[model samples]
Target: MPVNRRITLAARPVGHPQESDFALDEVDVSSPEAGEVLVRVLWTSVDPYQRGRMSEAKSYAPSLQVGDVITAQSVGHVVESNDRRFSVGDLAVGQLGWQEYATARAGTVRPVPEELDPQTLALHAVGMTGLTAYFGLFDVGKPRAGDTVVVSCAAGAVGQIAGQLAKIAGCRAVGIAGGPEKARDLIELYGYDAAIDYKNDGVAEALRGERVDVYFDNVGGEISQAVHRRLNLGARIVICGQVSQYNAERPELSFHPGLLIMFRARMEGFLVFDYAHRYDEAARKLAHWVASGKIRWREHVTDGLENAPRAFIGMLNGENRGKALVKVAERAE
Candidate 1:
């Protein structure tokens, strides 16, 4: 029998996840049933939202139960199959947990193109990060030419793409991030017109009297309030993720309702699952931009599955430069 190693949630975290929250165990790989395939995971994505899942909080998805494998989006290769739709060597992307092997239903996995770079495609510019940026900027925010678009968490996976997309749409892109180096990278590397280091400067003052037409908010809390204060008339705010407050022991600060009433600006929150039907459309456009050198994608990859918890915690602490990923296993040739 083939044995698989898996990381399971040992306890619900009160705030941030610790190493003890997870436990590793070896188990026999059960054969794929009639419509399932056994996948050997290659890479797994560690996103900010997963932090929410660690607690027994109400969310879009259910919280991780004790003893259950920690769930995540992973890209892997099919090593054995009972489903005719998938072949033994096909690479696939799906919601597989942090495991060396997973038996998944056929419908849940999407085959990845052999020509695509699995490392890059699995996380940024071509996957959920790209899709999040595309829909948040174009669909929700609807940035116009000459408009000033501000994105929080600017050096992050979704923020980098969203800022570049704003520039591509002929909008003035302003990114807000932590630290001096990330602020510089946002402008120099990702084509952002300007960047504000929230840790050092006051965000509202840094706006320099410019009215923001669109705010793509990835890190909520005080930053969201600051952006709300500078919103122009009829501006749109797209709420993507709230990484800044993810580790807070208590609920973090929020904006005043009066700001919304006074500015007449609209704020909308969306999940990427809402646009699942249009992923192909977003992927094609993002790929075209990437190929033309119009957009740049960045990733901070950790080399081992055992390091996923550490990487995830560090990401929330602003340790990662871009999308955080764990290389679980090597892709089969």
Candidate 2:
């Protein structure tokens, strides 16, 4: 019997997840049934949002129970199929969990176009990360030309795309990140017009010169509070992810609600699933930007499936530079 290696939640973590929270095991690979395909997983994503699913607390997405297979956006090639839409050797992506091989039923597995590079398209651009940035900025943020757009978590997956999208719309893209290096990448690598190192300087002080017209808040905390303080009248704040507080051991503090009234700005939180039907339209545009050299993509990959838990923890600590993912197996060429 072919064996499948996978990870599961061994225990619920109270604070930052450690290796003890995850358990790796091997099991028999199941064959696909009718309307399903057997996929040999190639790449799997490890996102900050996965941290939220670990707890029993309710979130927009369902919480994962202890001992449950850890789910992530996985890309793989079809090895056997009982579905008409997917033939052997077709590339597909879905929440195939952390297993080396996964069975994906129709509607669960989405086929990847043969022309698109599967490796580059795994979990970053053309996937949830890109879609999140696209919808968060365009739909929720509603940034305008000549607007001063500020993005937090500027070096991470969503923030990088959001900042670039802001610049593409003829806005001044400003970024605030944790480290000096990440701050530099926001400017030198991602094309942000201005970048702030929150670790070294006060984020509010750095942007005191201009009133921000749009704020893309990702790493919510003091950074978000500072940005809120600088919002211009009629500004929009897109609440994306709160990576800063995901691993907190205690209840985190919040900023004053009166700031929104004072600035006459609106703050809205969104989950990308709300606009899933319009993903194709955004993907086409993002793909064009990638092909035309407008958006520079990045992925920090950690080899081996067994290492995913630690890699995920590292990503939570802001160790990865860009989109954090794990390389589980090589895709069939």
Candidate 3:
């Protein structure tokens, strides 16, 4: 039997998370029961949303209690299987948390398609992150050809994909990121027409004279307010993850109802889980785009399962360039 090490919440984070907030523990690895499979986790994702779960504040999902395993989207090899759907060597991806080994019912994990080169892509692009960008932009933002689409956190996981998707839609994509390097990557790597470095160049100054038709806002703060002032008539704002406010103990309140009224704009918030039934539909299109070189992504991976906490903290602090993942094991034994 292999050692099963997991990262658990040692304390509820007050503001930005600290390494002391997490604890490492070794648990007994359980064997697969009927209709279940034991997975050897290879890659586990560390996303911004997990920050909300670390706090006691109420939100979309139940908060994580102290001592609970940090929730993560993981891709792993099925080492032991009791279900007919999965074999001992098959690969699967799902909410397997931050652990080296996990035992889940067969239905909880979807088998990775053989064609997907480097199965770790299942943790981000063409998975939940890509789906978030797809639904939020097309369904909520409703971008049209020739529209100026603006995305916040453009160098991050969902932001990069959204920017590319906007380009694919024949819209002019503008991305806002924290630093100059990230801003450069937005245009050179992610296909954004223009990039705004919010840290150096003010959002209002950078967006001057630009009529934003679609605002895919991932960071809601002063930056969003600046974009609101530039909304074109009937502009749409898709409220995705609020990376800026995720770690705040008391989130700042700000609103622009007057701007919405004047521009006749619409602001909507959506959860990727709401579109769960149509996942395969989105996946097919995203896979096609990725295969055709229409979409590209990068990963900022941390080595070792014990570093999952540090990786999660880094992601929340905007230290990661693209998708943040923790490598648990190289491969299944």
TM-score of each: 0.96, 0.97, 0.97
Q: Quick one: best lDDT, which candidate?
A: 3
Candidate 2 residue 206 C-alpha distance from true site, Å = 0.6
**TM-score order of candidates, best first?**
3, 2, 1
* lDDT (tens digit, per residue) of candidate 1 on 79-138: 989998999999888889888899999988888777675445756778888889999999
Q: Any idea what lDDT model 2 has?
A: 0.87
lDDT, candidate 2, at 180: 84
Most TM-score-accurate candidate? 3
For candidate 2, the per-residue lDDT at 286 reads 86
Positional deviation of residue 219's Cα in model 2 after best superposition, in angstroms: 1.2
Regions of model 1 farther than 4 Å from truth: none
Deviation in Å, model 1, residue 232 alpha carbon: 0.2
The number of clashing residue pairs in each candidate reads 0, 0, 0
Candidate 3 TM-score, true structure as reference: 0.97
